[model samples]
Target: MKNLDKLLEKYAKLCVKVGINIKEGQPLVINAPIEGLEFVRLLSKNAYELGASEVYVNWSDEVLTKLKYKNSPMEVFENYPKWKADSLEDFAKRGAGFISISSDDPELLKEMDPKKVAAANKSASIALKEYRKYTMNDINPWLVISIATRSWAKKVFPKLEEEKALKSLWDAIFKATRIDQEDPIKAWEDHMGNLKEKVDFLNNKKIKSLHYTSKNGTDLKVELPIDHIWAGGGSITSSGVPFAPNMPTEEVYTMPDKYGVDGVIYSTKPLNYGGNLIDEFKLYFEKGKVVDFSASVGEEVLKDLFAIDEGAKHLGEVALVPFDSPISNSNIIFMNTLFDENASCHFAFGKAYPTNIKGGEDMTDEELEAHHVNNSLTHVDFMVGDSTTSIVATTLDGKTLQIFKDGNWAF
Candidate 1:
């Protein structure tokens, strides 16, 4: 086997330098499954080298999580540890940059009760609402990335030997993240520049609404807020530092008016939420709220997700990604949102980000609500873009423009 350590170190450095853009004297916080300890250690080392003053790691274990779900009472699922939420709030208050690593077994909680999973997720979100606001508003830098783990690798390559599967998964991750490039940082710089150009074009058009259609029974219209900001590739922090929120991101996204969406859409890929896989799902919307939904698998989990809160039924984010992107071309399901969401166009339900609008960062909760930005304790992304999908945008000046055709950029 080749020396994987060097590649891992390089990947860590890229994340520290480009993902969160850790600054001098800044604190860094990491949340990851304990299986990612090796990469976490490398990341911590890289953060310190980048002049981070302190680094805090919140380690999690899938086995422990499984045990809790199996043995804990139902009430326990309705409460999140206050100390953990407070720690996140403290980090946000101190302007700490965050890097979250996902490397857990995709089906670890597959057998657990969907209601309990939803309850726990909702409780945690409610507990960390303030922290979520900070990150969502770009008050603090935050990044989400995935690492290859034994269980996750097995899920992706069930036919392969354990060691071979891990290697294949690692290779795919590296390529998707551009870590395989000769100069990964430089590659990211150029990639981000191209995405920014797209964002600028969209912003210049001042799109009023987007019309989506596909052969797969998807026909939806999404209204954009007047001050909607199309963000992609990388985002600037309150301090003017740039950071990439998702390592291999290829989408330009903005929040939609919570009450301005209407139509029906079908999922193009499976959504693995809370360790359960919801596949072949279709959602019907009326006035921007989910009126009905069904899934071929994990239907109960889908129902539990919508019951999280009122905002959970409304569209919070609408993101556009070409079908021929590197991740999509790889033809890997991934079963992970960080990768799948970027592979195709997607929408997030619940908890719209305040930073998605102009002057939104400073807006009060009521003010944001007045703009029709949904607020809730959950945000989940599901893919709906495929080769048959097409989209048109209506500009504020009443000009109609084709944005996507055959799942790629149109004009």
Candidate 2:
């Protein structure tokens, strides 16, 4: 691929300045793909320039991961290394900023043992459960960004050669993140303001529940917890540092009531979950649980997903995105959740965000459960909205408002 040195620099700057908002004297922990080593070098440089005290990199290689999974014993997947968990937790304790560059191959683990994959994921989640709280509760600033890898790019543009596919995917990513603009940071500020408007309006509505209907056979009702906070664009840590959790963010989301979702919903896009794709799926929800589901592709993977834990059978998040968003208008299914979920309204199955509820960070597990917050080892988002989708909200006081009509903001 041709080098875009300046463009890559701008991207790293935007992530450092706006994504994690690297604070002076604050340490940074970056999880990047081995393929992105050059990018990581640029990121470390940018972070240091912004006065980051130290930068730590944890490099991952999808090829290696798949190799290990293909040959490793099942027992190896059932136990997580204590030292790895300790390192992450220690970083969280020190108020370090985290940047995770997710660039997994959508089909990296296809045909691999689903049992091993599921078990390892579950074990890792359990090992780092406490570390997750820091990110989930906004206790520390953390950001999730994506990079174009050969495998991922090929999946997105299979007809193109590897180089062309990479360039195309990179162009799309830069466009989606506004990094292609002359003043990308300024553009993001303006975009953030637009998203904030929607967040403020939804917060003021004091919505009790939402009813979703669409031509794609989605008809569902989802209830929100009392005092649930709608957040988007960026968030502030308890200590006041600001950070954007995801690049190319377009949704203002909050947690759903664990036991308050019911009806049927159809997926509008394929879900590349943990290296396996699940598409053309329909989930039947009853009392917030996944009573049943059907997926034309990867049905066994779907079964292994919710079977990770009890909370996997229920929804933990409800995010609102418009069908007319920038990414949606691109008309490309990236097959990556970080981008796809931003393109349309989606729901996640697994643990809820503590930051979504008032004083939720301080709430005990039992108290959170009492407040209808679901807990699980997984938080997988699947798109379920399109141009024909409509959403109506009912406020606590009985007034109703059209939140989305024909898949775009109606307010």
Candidate 3:
């Protein structure tokens, strides 16, 4: 926790300069938890210093959100306010740079009715469908970063008191984002360069499919779309501006063919979904659909997730991360997808990113579906890789190759 303020100032600059890479004349919109007010102020100041046209912060407090769920009738969760959706559309149309400060309490809604949570989630996703396309398609810049809150920090460092846990969690976050280093931006450039190497390799190989096996009883294979692009480290806007989507990203990922997956996969870590944790889950797939599934925890929530839409039962993304990755070495479970998903190999259910496929940007939703890309209202990621995992690829040459050995990338 030494130099906490100094580290935070550096973090704010990094989020503006490197994370979202805000353009000079573009406005910035931030979605932040009230607990992160101090950091949000710093972030807005940095954006203004970089010549951002304006800064808007949308404050969210989970306590109020949970209160609504507790007191509102069932019908209340079934509909979302159209005015809020329209406001987001207005921002995206003006080419706003967006940042999300996520400090989630892993078990905040543990005792809430799963049905209510599911309904609210579905309604919001439906209403915001248009606004989501901008970030999903890389039409505008977007980034997700985190700060430590009492509940979230305690979840990560359970044995410590509130203040101690906050300090420890902040330390973990700084190290993960390299904000603890002398020059975080330069460190990120070096990290992205390494990720670019893997991207270039995968693109050059023209891989057909990947076969995976692990000690946790995972034996699955997922095929790549004909023109799928492997992307990681950074992303570019439709107009050519570059930005990093996830501050501490370490995975190279692409969409998998919606109809070309088979076998089974097991979760290596708890999946924190809508404040509920689904742990020790096993999903069985056949020809790309999740035919059967089981979870030792939050089974009802898992069911509601799959019920979101037909595409929810199919694979949208396949990502690769080394077992010896920095986050993995830290031995801390942040219980947040942005952090945990980067710690190991993972897969997403529901919508596939439009930018993942060649010419996908201009293709209509129907066209994308015809090309075998899964589409849904939600995209949820869960970890599955460990040191015992191995992935074999069938290249364009029609032969088996080792893409991953012992959970790390293999030449």
Candidate 4:
């Protein structure tokens, strides 16, 4: 086995230096899954070494969530803990660096209620939207990464033994996140430079609309905001401090007009909601709003999510991940949206991106509405890539150009 201790130390240092850009005397907050305990602990130790004032680790366990699903009452799902809400606010006000880790056991929810799972996860956020708003606004720097647990490693490599699978997945994630470079920081700088090129090209082209079509789908016409900034690779908070968004990412994304999307789209991956798995879901949109949705499983979860608020039904993030992405080349269907979206192009529902739109967050509700900035606490992403799916940009000058062909970037 590779020296796990050394790996943890190296990973933590990278997170502090490159991911979160930990500053002296800065407070740090980690929302880590139990699977990531080792990395979290090492990160805390590193934070102290970096002169952090305090390091808070908020741990979550899928087993605990499973128990709640099996035992908690329906009403209990709606109410959130006041302390938890306060904690999010505290982190935001303190300008704490937020780091999140994802390492879920894929089969844990194989038999659970997808709707109930979705409800449980969304309940806390809906109850704490204000604090979430602060974090989303990049009140401070933030970083997110994934760890390989026994179960997650199993999901990634079903044929291998636990130890081997873990090593393999670890190698994959490390490489994908650019942790193996001789100078990883410089590697990120170069990668972000390439992403900036794509964004700059799109921004300069003044693309006014996006049109998409595939075999069973032929229905989305999206309007892009004038002066919108296409962001990808890494992002700085409103504070001008840089941080990594996705652990292994290759996408330039912008917010879509909440009221400007029209058509039907199919989900390319299974969704985990309310501790249950929802599969084969299809959504129909009308005038930038999700008017209807259906799934072979967990339809109720989607219904409840749509009922959250007007903004919940609107689109938030519109991202493009090329078909040749490393994760995509793995050719393994994780059945999880996060990994699946990283493999290919995807979009989200709810909570618009402030950086994507010009003056997005500062705009009044009226002003934002005019610009089609979607608003909601629930931002859910789903994959939509297919071999025939393509994207075309309609320039502001009324010229049409192909940007992607068969799930690949044309530029």
What TM-score, over all chains together, does every model reach?
A: 0.98, 0.98, 0.99, 0.93
Q: Give the TM-score of candidate 1.
A: 0.98
lDDT of each: 0.92, 0.92, 0.92, 0.78
lDDT of 4 by residue, 1-411 (tens): 466566667778878877888888789989888878778888999888988889988888988977877887877776788888898788778888888886777667656665555566678767788777666676677776877778778876899988999888787777777777767778887888888898888878988889887776655788877767788887887778888766667888898877778888887777754444667788888888888888887777678777777888888988988888878887867655556778878888788777678777687768877876888878877777767778999998999999889878887
TM-score of 4: 0.93
Candidate 1: how many backbone clashes?
Answer: 0
Please give the distance, in angstroms, between residue 165's alpha carbon in candidate 1 and its true position after superposition. Answer: 0.8
Worst 10 residues of 2 by lDDT: 1-10
RMSD of each: 0.9, 1.1, 0.9, 2.1
Please list the residue runs of candidate 4 whose C-alpha ends up more than 4 Å from where it truly belongs after superposition: 113-118, 216-218
Q: Give lDDT tens digits, candidate 2, residues 298-342.
A: 999999888889999999899999999999999999999999999
- Candidate 3: where are CA atoms >4 Å away? none
Candidate 1 residues 67-127, lDDT tens each?
9999999899898999999999998999899999977787889988777898898898889
Pairs with steric clashes in candidate 2? none
